[model samples]
Target chain A: MKYCSHCSNEVTLRIPEGDTLPRYVCLHCQLIHYQNPKMVVGCIPEWEDRILLCRRAIEPHRGKWTLPAGFMENNETLPQGAARETLEEANARVEILDLYAAYSLPHISQVYLLFRAKLLDLDFSPGIESLEVKLFEERDIPWNEIAFQVIRTSLERFLLERRTGAPVFHTGKIDRSPI
Target chain B: MKYCSHCSNEVTLRIPEGDTLPRYVCLHCQLIHYQNPKMVVGCIPEWEDRILLCRRAIEPHRGKWTLPAGFMENNETLPQGAARETLEEANARVEILDLYAAYSLPHISQVYLLFRAKLLDLDFSPGIESLEVKLFEERDIPWNEIAFQVIRTSLERFLLERRTGAPVFHTGKIDRSPI
Candidate 1:
């Protein structure tokens, strides 16, 4: 950060006393600006035998299919955030079963928490952030047109463990090449 | 966030086009600063029949005992962040078994991800942020002296599920009254 968000003073990179990492400390107020990884909570919303997916209407992967998700907002639990994202992106409601996948993307400083959920109904359409919303069976999934790598992996894991109907816990790192 | 960190321009809160929530939008650079919940990763470091606990040397809960945890940083996985926090808070090394508990503290905009782990050795002391580091058996735990609500709940669940020796997945929310 060039300027302190707190005092509008200039900031400098320095390790505070009794701390290991250097942070952006305000020149006047000494307010430390700590940047932590954010949680991107969403769900694998299932309807009958099909899973819900949204086509992006915005940049960074426009028109690519993805599980409806977004950044977790303040004053909401992970599952609550997941449900909110689903409603926002796809105009869908879901009953969250369990947290299914947590992929740590150090390259982007994001932790994606995907829940295993059942869609309340098939009454879903594209929200503002989505070009369209649709349900896809495993064999009918547009694998080549998937959005994020983590989403693709989540879909794969979900399909793999579908037989047992057991919630799968997954943790992995995504090494995305810098654009 | 009064000023845009990118351009040092004054910012205004507004809901962007097609967005539900308002964000800190810069007037000059049009940079939208969106805040999200952060992950606090740590472990319940177990050494045989006891678990490690640290007394905080910092504010928010100074002098109270808690499981070693801190905000997850950039360039780290969930497990790695948990391990790092354990090492930093208690100067203890641990072998992480499985992600045991995840508690969402919406009142604080934080998610606590606690892992079930085995302490590598007893050669551990308090780190800079901790005044004291010690091991306590289930019965010897200072239940009243526990730091945060999540920490107390984590300890209780750990004790309750110790008999099965199987990792438990828990997700819950905490509501704090405004001071």
Candidate 2:
């Protein structure tokens, strides 16, 4: 936001009249620019009694396991994003059953939305981003080596709710500091 | 992505002789990286036969009308994100009714999920990122000036579904060209 959109002038970051945080304000248009976090949508795609998982072929969490997930694209709906990610990562078609989890990480400025999906077919292979694609039963999850905190939490909740057959809702800020 | 996780060393991004797209290949630790998109969730909150709309105080479309929406946070559900966005933008509580629309836009790299929610109370005001907040009947919607293509399409489908009682399930690229 170095340039202003209204008057085509350069902008600067400054605190407003009654604010504490610095904001990007266009000097020409007097408009304040607000930046929000990006969104991630994916699914816990299931076939029979097992949940789908992908092995990463990239950095940040290379070789780690994760649900098929990705950043939301422009002009697409959440479900569409989830479904597309599933196909892109696992090469599988799925039917979204319900939205299972939503997570906000203010630390990284990201929000993740996950859903429970039923696999439309048993056939699947690694997509461009995945090294290997596989399914795991609840008890067989590789908990310690899961890719991200959000993925672990969503998987835990999904397994718990499935076992108890009860609706589950959890809300709290994550203590991200490492032990 | 070109390095092994177990033994830190350079790897390849080339698919095997019989494979399609290039994938991360670790020669040492045999690790791969998986890349996926994020998810965004929001709601079309309706109050007494009118829909809640907010004038965005931020870009990509500053001062444009839109439904209350934001990225899904970590450790929350899709419904929770939708409800949270509704509250954050409208200062109103809502009960989510049904999953309304899902869209995928590979161009801008986002997936948006939307829900239909019944406003719990009509009390609301513009939140931090909104210049103004108000409700409008279907016919009175400012379709041309809606903030995002996803929002415009979702609102159109929602209104049409409300009238014709036929659900909309779109699966294709969204026409995101400026109006």
Candidate 3:
């Protein structure tokens, strides 16, 4: 936001009239530019009581296991984004049953939304971003090798609720001490 | 991300041999930076069959109509994000019913996830980022003056489903032509 889109002039950071935080405001057009965090949508897709997990072929945590997820695209809805990511990474079709989780990481400037989805079929193959795709039983999850804390937490909660028959909705900030 | 986080050495973006896209490769520490898109979550909360909407108090569409939404925060889940935003802007509490839409807009570099939330209570007021808050019946919706296309489309689909009793899940790209 070095230049103002409205006025085509150089912008400066300043606290508006009575605002607390500094914001980029155009001197010419008086427009302010805001840089907001993004959204990632994915799913804990289940097939006959098994959860689908994909081994990453890409970096960050390459070869680590995670549920199929990706950034939401423009114009598509959240379920569409989740479904697309599932299809792209696991070659799986799923019907979204519920939005189970929404996570925000202010440290990394990201928000993750995970859905509880039901697999339409048992067939799946690893898509381009995955080294392999497989379904994991409750006790067989690779807890130590999960790609992100969010994935690990979501899976843990999912498994726990399945066992206890009491689904808990957790809302608040996550402690990022591990990552 | 062209510097090593571990060693503070120069890095480069490259495709390792047969890779399809470039990734940050740190030569000194052998670290690879994998960047993923962030997530934005929001909700179209319904009250007594009417949908909740807010007038933006901030730019780029200040004074325009939009559903209460914001990027997911670090300690919250998607449903929590939507609920938080609903609470923040509309001063209302909601129970998320279903994932109504998911989309990615490459043009704006954003992925938006919207949920169809059921308003838990009717008491409401405008919050910080909103100029005004109100609920509108299907025919009373200010369609032409909506802030974002995504909100307009979501409201349209929501109203349509209410009337037709048929589910609408949009997966294709939204036409962004000027109205």
Give the TM-scores of the predictions, in the order they appear. 0.96, 0.55, 0.57
Question: Which tens-of-lDDT digit does each residue in A1-179 have in candidate 1?
Answer: 79887677788999988788889988798789999998999999988889999999998899899999999998899999999999999999999888888788987888899998999987889999999999998899999999888898778878988866865676677767422
Could you report the DockQ of all the candidates, in the order they appear?
A: 0.76, 0.11, 0.15
Ranking by TM-score: 1, 3, 2
Candidate 1 local lDDT, B1-179, one digit each (tens): 88787777788999988778899998788888888888999999998989899999998879889999999998788989999999999989999878888889888888999889999999999998999999998889988888888888777877888876865777877675321
Number of backbone-clashing residue pairs for each candidate, in the order shown: 0, 44, 31
Better of 1 and 3 by lDDT: 1
lDDT of 3 by residue, B22-124 (tens): 7777676676655555556798887777888999999878989999997665445667778888888888989986666766554455566788788888798
Q: Of the true contacts between chains A and B, what fraction does model 1 have?
A: 0.73
Q: Against the true structure, whose DockQ is highest?
A: 1
Comparing 1 and 2 on lDDT, the stronger one: 1
List runs of model 2 lying over 4 Å from the truth: A1-11, A15-34, A166-179, B1-179
| Complex DockQ, candidate 2 | 0.11
CA lDDT, every model vs. true structure:
0.87, 0.74, 0.75
Q: Which runs of model 1 end up more than 4 angstroms from their true locations?
A: A177-179, B177-179
Error of 3 at B156 (Å): 15
Please report the candidate that would top lDDT against the real structure. 1
Better lDDT candidate (2, 3): 3
Summarize candidate 3's per-residue lDDT along A54-114 as a digit string, tens digits.
9999988999999999866644566777999999999999998666776666566667678
